[model samples]
Target chain A: MIEQYLLHLFIIACVYAILAMSLNLAVGFTGLLNLGHVAFYAIGAYTSALLAVGLGVPFWGGMLAGGCMAALFGYLLSFPTVRLKGDYLVLGTLGFTIIVEAVLKNWASLTRGPLGIAGIPKPRLLGLSLSPLPAYALLALAAALLTYWLLSLVVASPFGRTLKAIRDDEVAAGALGKDTFRAKAKALALSAFLAGVAGALYAHYITFIDPSSFSITETILIFSMVLVGGTASLLGSVAGAALLVLLPEPLRFLPIPSDIVGGMRQAIYALLLVLVILKRPQGLLGEDTLRDAWARARRRRKGA
Target chain B: MDILPQLIMNGLIAGSVYALMAAGFSLMYGLQRFMNVAHGATYLVGAFAAYACARLAGMPLALSFAIAVLVATGLGVAINQLVYVPLQRQKEKDRALLLASFGVFLLVEAIILMVFGADVKSFGLPVRKGMDVLGAVVTPVQLVIILAAPLVFLGLWLFLYRTRTGTALRAAADNEAIARTMGVNVRAMTTLTTALGSALAGVAGILVALEQNLEHSMGLPAVLKGLTAAIIGGIGNVPAAILGGYLLGLAENLGIWYLPSGYKDAIAFVILILFLLVRPQGFFGTRRREEAGG
Candidate 1:
């Protein structure tokens, strides 16, 4: 039974790994502060769920379609926010998430409202059913690895350097003849695509989907993962995702009261977020240890 | 029976509360130059503290309110000192400050949920008879709230324009480097701003708790609407912000008459996006501003 449980955990970690890596492409590398990242996940989940249920599409086709749908919205969302920065950008994205949730909740004819969509067929790949516990572990692992490899390639290419350049200094990047808006939009689209794939994987595995599943909590959780693991690092995304997935596991083994467990987990997450932002803004595995910045701070304080 | 009076009365009540929040919000934004979202948590702290004192401890409502304001004020100043001040000292600090503020917000929200279970709470004040005014039944508490907006605006205007300390605070907010060079004690001014702004938030929280059901998740959405009102009036303009609040409250109430109530938050988002896209400076602002974080 523990074997089954651990395998389940691994599969969930795989999905989170995909989500974290994709989010890192936008927030970590490109500095987007996309508070509506969950919108993409919801879009992907619903898109794949609808395709699978309404048309009997296989797992691969449904998942790809989900990713494409999310990517399209991600690219579209980026255009309006290309010029906004800091707090304005945050508000804009937060509004999008609210709008997405509103639509998902009110469009009862399609989404079934709060009752949610159920009876989703388990994932299938190449005519092989991946519904068994151990089989799902391997399938999720393979999917996560494929995502990692492809994103790693994207992060290492000139395009990745351009994203970092734009993050560090957009005006300079634009001066260098790099189309900043287009590049950032493409990066967001790719990130959303991976998130969509993860969402589809989650939906089929859980065999249910709802609007509440893709709330602001998901955004906070994934954002914390990227920050804790190390921003701008692909491996950090995997590590962060795994760490968060495993963090509250010990709660089940403890003797804490059931009612307080959820609150305790949230408290721990929020505490970690504040600590990480305050103590290590570069994150656990991020580059540039801020030595130069500290020296400047010291000199400034000394009235130099 | 005409429904216009009741709707307008409801709009005025909501608008006044939102204006109080926006006044504090704009002050902090001006002083810190970033959205101090943790200010929203002050509402939670104030309302919860008041509820605990008044209902649980059986204290008088006025005394409970005073204690709540003090606690919220202290918390606000503590956040400014412990969290935001450090971030403000760094280069490329705008994003970090905003995120840190959000982190503090979530941290407080989680703690509140833990301490006060996820249940809707109320102060259980004795119900007062409603008086008919222009075919609408208006309660005493509603009248107080409706009057509070203009009173707060007048008080803020007097303090900012007539007092030497207030002028000094404005100078600091306008340009910190210049203010410091002029020996303005910019840090003290910021602390003062936090204290004043948070006290206002505490009052607004108590008003909201009195008129509506109190829940753990109520703070953020209400404050987001306050932020919307602030944006509509232009970020730092006081009179315009108050005007914007009334306008938004009126819009929301009147919009609900035609559409489902579930679309209330959606309406705010639509307005926010439209304003952000078409009129970034808001309706009554002379300054044109945009930043790419460079």
Candidate 2:
């Protein structure tokens, strides 16, 4: 039973690592800062859940379909808000996130509303069930490693250089004969795909999926993980995810009341985020620093 | 009972609240160009502060509300002094500011949960009867909400148009660099905007709490609606925010007549998406400014 508990914790960490890595690709590498990323995760989870439960699709197929569906949505969403900058872009993505939640909650026929889709079948591997503790843990670990490997490859590629250039300075990148908009849109799609796969893994591992599980609360937690690990670093994503998952464990032994425990946890994460952003804007592994950005803002102000 | 008139009345009352919230929220958006999501926390603080006064302390309703508004404004200024001002001193980027604001939101939410618990609370005031208004049943609290909203807006209008500080605030919002060149204290204006915005949000919280049940979770949704309305009217445009708020409230209420009532929130988001896609500048914002902002 103790081993099972540890494996469960490991599996949850692996899931968040995948999510954080994917978000890093967009935020740290591509500079989209798309707050609506969790909407894709929710879509992926719900899509996989529905496929397996309602249509009898296999796990691998449902997972791929979920990734593709989320990618499609992410790509489509980029076109309309491609011209919006900063706060406007954030607002656009936020609108999408809220709409996704509204659909998940109100469309009772498709999503089963707030009750969420249940009875998700566990994945089978090598003609064997993955429901056992060790098997599921191995599956989660493999998926996370595969995501890291592939995302690192993408980040190290020549196209990745173009993405960084755009993120650093879109006009300069455009002047360098790069199609920054298309690159950003593609990066968003890839990020969404990975996040969706993570969502699928979560759905299968937990064997239950709900709208509430993917709310902005989850997004903020994911954001904290990414920030703690430092943005734009694949290894950092894993470290951040694992660290945060374990961070709350010690609190369980404390004599705090049950009512304020959740609040305490949230406060911890929030405080960490605030400290990290204020003191280390680039994160634990990333390159951007608040001081440097401040200098740039000063220069721009003087120029203006 | 006439469904249309009743919906319209509901819409007007809700619009008033939304406008009040939007005006406060948009002030920061215009002047400082940061997503101060803690505005939601301020709204929560306003409602809960009133709860603390009226329900917990047994203060008279008018005094409780007055104190709530004051406490909320103080909370807003506190957030400014602690978070916004420091970030500005560092010349922080928009993303950093946004993240910090989210941090404030989370921190405040935790505090609220700790102090108030998760259970819902209210003033538990004596029940009042509804008055007939063009075939619509309107309660006194809601009527006061409807009336109070515009009076506050008028007050805000007067402050912006008739006051020198308001002109300086507008200048800073229009172009921070230019405002500075013209000898405007951009930091001071930003701080002032934060205070005004929080005050507006505080009033909105009190009015809405009087009409609806107060919960710790109430802040995010109310501020979100205010955000939608602000975006609809144009993020930085104050008067336009009022129009946007009314439009959202009306759209949300009347939309349930044709679509399922559960889709009311969806309708607001749909409008937001449409506005974002087609007219990113919104109703009052200039097209040129959108490109410039990008």
Candidate 3:
């Protein structure tokens, strides 16, 4: 029983790790303070769920469609709003998330209102259903590892350097002849794609999907995971996800009332977020990504 | 009774409350570049404070309102001191400040939920007959709101234009470094700005609670509407924010005439996105130099 519980926790951690890493690309790498990252996650989950449950599509096909749909939305959203800098950009992203949630809740015909879609079929490999906790855990683990590897490669590529440049100073990056807008759009699309995949995995694993699961709180949770783990560090994303996923689990064993537990967990996260941002903005596992980048740029100028 | 007049009156009432919120929000945004997500929490605190004072402590209605505004102002200033000040001192990134504010918002919200349960609370104000205004029925409390909003705006305008502290705040908003060099206490000005802004939010919250009901989750929607109004008016422009608030109120109310009432919440977001994409400088805001990126 203990092992089974551990596996369940592990799967949740893996799902959150993918979310954190995807958010890290926009927030950590590209300097986009996207408060609406979970919108794309919802988009992906709904797309996949509808396709698999309604159209009888395979899991792989649904996942691909989910990623593409979310990416399309990312590109469409970023094309116009990417030029906005700082807090304005943050508001723009936040507006997107609120709209997405409103649509999901109000569009009864499509999302079934608040009732939510259920009985999502499990993933099947070679006509063999991966329904057991252990099999699903392996699937989630593989997806998380793949996401990390792919994201690491992206960050190490020339595109990654350009993103860092833009993050540090968009004007300087522009002066150097980089298409900063296109780069930001691409980054947003890629980030959305990854988040969508994570959403797909979550849908299949949980076997239930609802609009409530993709609220602003979930976005904040993923964001906190990124910040607490260490922005701009793939490993930090994994560790942060694991830590947070496990942090509240021990509280279940406590004699506290179930109703208060949810609020307590959120309070703990809020405290951690405030403390981390104030005391250790570099986070626990990685260097201060944006500040260090700015410092490095300053040092380079001084050297010149 | 003409439905048009009723809708227009209803819209104006809603607009007046949003104007209060937007004006304060715009004032703070003008000075501090970061959006304080905790602004909503402060509003909630104010509403709940009034609720607690009136229902639990059995304070007089007027006294409870005053106490609520004071508490909100204190909470706002405290948040700035505890969260934003330390990060500013460290020269932390804007994202950090934003995240910290979000954290504070969540923390305060959870605390409010814990203390006041998740159930919605009401002020239990005594019911009175609705007065007819221009062929439309208006509640006494709503008339008070309508009358009070303009008075508050005028008071704020006079304070900003005629008072010494207000001038210092304007100076800081124009250029913080220059304001500091010119003997303006930048720190004190920020604290004052937060207090005033939060007090406005508090008033808006109380008025809203008196009109409707109070829920812990009301903060986010209130903040969003205020934000939409501020952005539509042009960020940092007080007069424009007020105008935007009225405009948003009208648009939202009239919009439900054509579409489902459920889409009422979405109208603000749509307007926000449209403004962000088409004219981010908004109705009165000058195009910022930084926005002109390559």
Largest TM-score belongs to which candidate? 3
Scored by lDDT, the top model is 3
Of 1 and 3, the candidate ahead on DockQ is 3
Clashes (N, CA, C under 3 Å) per candidate: 0, 1, 0
Which digits, one per residue and each the tens of the lDDT, describe model 3 over residues A13-105? 999999999999998888888887899999999999999999999899999999999999999989667878777787888888988988998
The true-versus-predicted C-alpha distance at residue A2 of model 1, in Å, is 1.8
How much is the lDDT of residue B187 in candidate 1? 86
Q: DockQ for candidate 1, please give it.
A: 0.52
Q: Could you give the CAPRI-style class of model 2?
A: medium
Please give, as one word, the docking class of candidate 1.
medium
lDDT of each: 0.85, 0.85, 0.89
Once fitted onto the true fold, the runs of candidate 2 whose alpha carbons sit more than 4 angstroms away are: A255-257, A288-304, B89-92, B175-184, B288-294
User: Candidate 3 — which residues are off by over 4 angstroms?
Assistant: A288-304, B291-294
Q: Please name the candidate that would achieve the greatest DockQ relative to the true structure.
A: 2
TM-score against truth, every candidate: 0.94, 0.94, 0.95
DockQ of 2: 0.63
